[model samples]
Target: MGDNVVVSNMELERLLSMKGGKGEASYANNSQAQAIHAKSMLHLLKEALDGVELHAPNIPFVVVDLGCSCGTNTINVVDVMVEHIIKRYEALGCNPPEFSAFFTDLPSNDFNTLFQLLPPMANYGNSMEECLAANNHRCYFAAGVPGSFYRRLFPARSVDIFHSAFSLHWLSQVPESVEDKRSDAYNKGRVFTHGASEITTNAYKKQFQRDLAGFLNSRSIEMKSKGTMFLVCLGRTSVDPTDQGGAGLLFGTHFQDAWDDLVQEGLISNEKRDDFNIPVYAPSLQDFKEVVEADGSFSINKLEVFKGGSPLVVNQPDDASEVGRALANSCRSVAGVLVDAHIGDKLSEELFLRVEKRAANQGKELLEKLQFFHIVASLSFVL
Candidate 1:
């Protein structure tokens, strides 16, 4: 296969989901950084459910979590949504409707693990009977829908509410121009937006805009009129897409340094490092607004930027090696699969080990450098 063959738009849908299972390196264990953002945004989620027109008692009240990698954070979000929504209906003296929660990601996601983690559902499916029998106290039925969010997952006007966190920044694939070796826009040495050339950066920006628009368009079609979407994802504070403090901190130099170590040792060729680029782009606040406003389907109710600790480490304890290993595990959880796809398992393991050592030796300096921001927004469909 050619260097850029893996860059196909559909191919990444299979390749880029967070690593699966319940291991220490699984996304399930390494997702606290994501949980922090989702928890902070629960108010917005409640705000969204507040606006939704509750389904009739006979109809299921549908909620969908887009890009819901197999993790507890996914369940926590749905639990909060179900709880707050039930409260809203009760306050209005209405019979709470059956709830159907759909957890969606790529087909390769660990749905089995996610289903096992749910709070003792009677049985997992869309059946209202299962919802009633699974656990009398739990009112919702949970089912995993495996697909990309850039396209429609549910039927037209079927979903009443949607939630996604730390997911939208991922483009459907590496931008084609960036992967084409002959193109000036090729991301030659760099794997991500930070420190990229203007041409390479523009490719990433355009891809994000297209993907976000597709996401909104799909949701608009699938959502009931006035249905709500609450989204939270990695974002950049700087106007410049290539700013080091934003996505660059999360996806840029540290991995490159590890790749450099492999190259120096002749374990992998420099071209192997140069050929791969992470298919994620942290949009600026302006970039997000422009796409949503242009799409003109979902009326933006709330949009704002919030900063967070490095997505890798939450508290940043005094121990450098500890933080370093945390950072490495975090990367392994999200991108280790992609790296493994590119180079192979053994080399990918070696590469992340180097990342741990490098971050440990660099210590507090590395932690400070990786601080990044998040974008949270709530939108309601408008006919």
Candidate 2:
């Protein structure tokens, strides 16, 4: 919602990542909100696991967590999946098989931190004696997979269950047309397609369609027949990407003001801000259904849109600025890397500080508007 600025090209993959490590500002600490989303979907996940047909006994039951940013949230989801899977086998009167959990993310992801948080595998080692001694709780071996989910990451029929949370909204890259100066869809001053023009929004939607298709097709090849996939990601309550009430899908006005401040001070050019577009999209339920049906690899078991309120807002902070700062930190955990890559670390830090300050000044009313909508889907490969 600012003046049109010139454009430039920048690679997306090298910059896309969550803030790593266990530091106060890292994704591990800021991801409680994401953890909440995972918790809300547990019932559906358990129901899906109940129907999982156990493979030959004694073979490892493979589970993959796609887009597993460095955090306990990732570990928590894997634990629930593995534990439920084992329970499913037990309910079927079959001995639970060993488990393999693969945590996958971009190469830029901080795998070191993720591994450090993993429970000791000595208790869950391949040996049956160790597994029994540990009371069969720690029966899964963990591995880090550094790559994009849009590309194939596993061998055919290898994975038994796939779980991804708060991840798939990220497109493999921003659409080139939106950044092209000569194109009609050039996004101009906006960093995301929240209330952008119909043309600009359509460009992003097309990119999302391609990205989602690639993701599903890759999993179809890697996952075994009849395997299950559970996904949770940001989505829109409205079909129109131009809708401002699209669950406050991305950063709010405060973030834009921060960038404007930089531009006014001549710290960064307006063109630079224009060039930066976050490679994320929140599609409506209809958008998701169309893509899956067209792909024809998996049948959708359940797909629904649900609202989630942040703990920052839900707990009711007495100081509005406290909630503002908390919300900004959560955003920085995901967007800081990209901002730093585009405008250097010093400026990026200053920008986020400005955002926090502005958001705080705006107070409770503004922060409350930043609601989230989640699309939870359960799908299985066609037999």
Candidate 3:
């Protein structure tokens, strides 16, 4: 996956690829849980905003969505945030500051789709008029800032509130040490570190620590004193989620096994299979605590782990095949391009079909057995 990591058509950074287009092909349908979770996490934002001291009345109040894919969940997240802050201002009987919401993601992100969902006249994008109109806030702004969040994307102390959901599991880049030919942690069979040899798992851990250290350090420079960041993503509720059945971590394991089967049948090469690894990691609770404690950048105000339930869609069939197909579509919608980009699209269709078949075979029991655990945390920037 060395050459495969770089897509032939571009040099742009690609994270989890969101489904493209305006209709069924898009991610709008599959992200219902994200929207629900976005709404549910409002209290964290509110509690954090309660601590923000706006020294200058004319300065715009700022909120940024770190990985706002296609803006479906972004709208609700920003909407709820504005409502929360406005209520705080009202509670204090003070004039509210102007609002500015920044929606950021990788360069390859479908920002056009995200822009369509926003107010049209913003040119690049700056306002969600009708939503903010209801509140007493006079001016509301929204914009797409395309870049990797692991680096500096804004000025020092320029940010007030930061929010990210269902993102951050992605590593800035795949760990280079795992691919070493002479290394014991080569990850010869599977594409992830989740139940691999101790060397492999620890190699992945070191990458997360390095990447997360940079993430925290960069944010520390840009965040105002006590400015809070709320992050939620799939993570291990235990020290290791490898033993956790029905956890989202298994999807890669299942897919990698299928890839191996395909390799065995001479459909795909084992070298390509071994070379390709999913560039994501679900940090354990202790992993998160260790990073937060060592970084000296932020204090954890809250951290909670809970299982997320999949909402049944309207007009969707209640059978195993359809259920599995939808799940596959959702998977494809999110990570298909990333997979194809890493290995080329020649085998992608058949690969995901195999995934769909396996999922469908599980039937309604899949629904019963499906368990997605999320870690939501509130962090206050250390001054």
Candidate 4:
């Protein structure tokens, strides 16, 4: 990925820091909601563990939450899993088996935030020191592993359960065609229909296929036979090429419009636009399944979809006007890069206001254009 498009580790930390202001708060809020979806995956893991225990009663169990940002969600999942395991063991009239966990994410993610959260979490029942000393029936350890999930980040057959939430949909990098050329297709005030086509849609699907294969292949090597993986990601259901032009389309139509507006206002120069494209991609359900099943690495155990609602309506009271404002603000952040690229630093304020005004005019009912999907899928395979 190009340095400009890739959010460096330090930048990610800064964005998550309390000092980063409302942006950080927005990110945290969104992440927390996304984390709730992780609970759906946990349900599948419990089923897989049940199946495995029927064969290997004494085998150790390890769960890795890939892309475990700041470890808040990881800690939550661990607490629930531990409780469930204890109940199961009690029914069996035996002690709980040993368990370990690994929290993995980009090196730039806030591991310090996770560490700080852990001491408090460990002290919630018994102090962390006490838990470690009393480790007999079950042992829990959490550590940050810094690396991209697209590459092998764990040893082969080292993990029993693997889970990732709202993270894998991001492409390794922006599409080369978009990155290599400065096309008018990226201009602002352009309608979504102007450039919507099956060709572009197919290209995105192929890119997702490649990334998903890489992700699953690495996991296949690291997961033991009969191991399970629960992946929940942002996805779309519509196959109409035009519907693909929604604001949710990453680094494509909506983003291009932002850049175009900035350039027209003389805020950013075309030279900078040459190097700009967001390094995120959202895939359709069919494309997602193709990548997961193609490698023969996993068997689909369950699949379900839920509305992502509006990125803007989060945590707000159910007021139509306020919801509209929230959605507009969220859209602006995504479109801001494009606007900044064209308008330069000078007119950014003006461009932002204009974008906000445009969203308000469009209103909440129209904000359904920003709706996305939360896809939950479970897979199991023999290594």
Is 3 or 4 the stronger prediction by lDDT? 3
Model 4 misplaced stretches (Cα beyond 4 Å): 1-26, 35-60, 119-139, 182-195, 245-257, 314-325, 328-357, 366-369
Q: Report, for all candidates in order, the number of backbone clashes.
A: 1, 0, 2, 13
Per-residue lDDT of model 1, residues 256-342, tens digit only: 789889889988777888877888888888999999999999888889888766676546567888878988898889998888878
Q: Which is the leading candidate under lDDT?
A: 1
For model 1, state the Cα shift of residue 269 in Å. 1.3
Report the lDDT of model 1 for residue 339: 85
- The TM-score of predicted model 2 comes to 0.92
Model 1 error, position 232 (Å) = 0.7
Model 3: clashing residue pairs? 126-141, 126-142
TM-score winner between 2 and 4, please give it: 2
Clashing pairs in 1: 122-134
Ranking by TM-score: 1, 2, 3, 4
TM-score of 1: 0.92
Task: Give TM-scores for every candidate, taking all chains together and pairing residue i with residue i.
Answer: 0.92, 0.92, 0.88, 0.74
Count of backbone collisions in candidate 1: 1
C-alpha lDDT (0 to 100) for residue 20 of candidate 3:
60
Whole-model lDDT for model 3 versus the true structure?
0.70
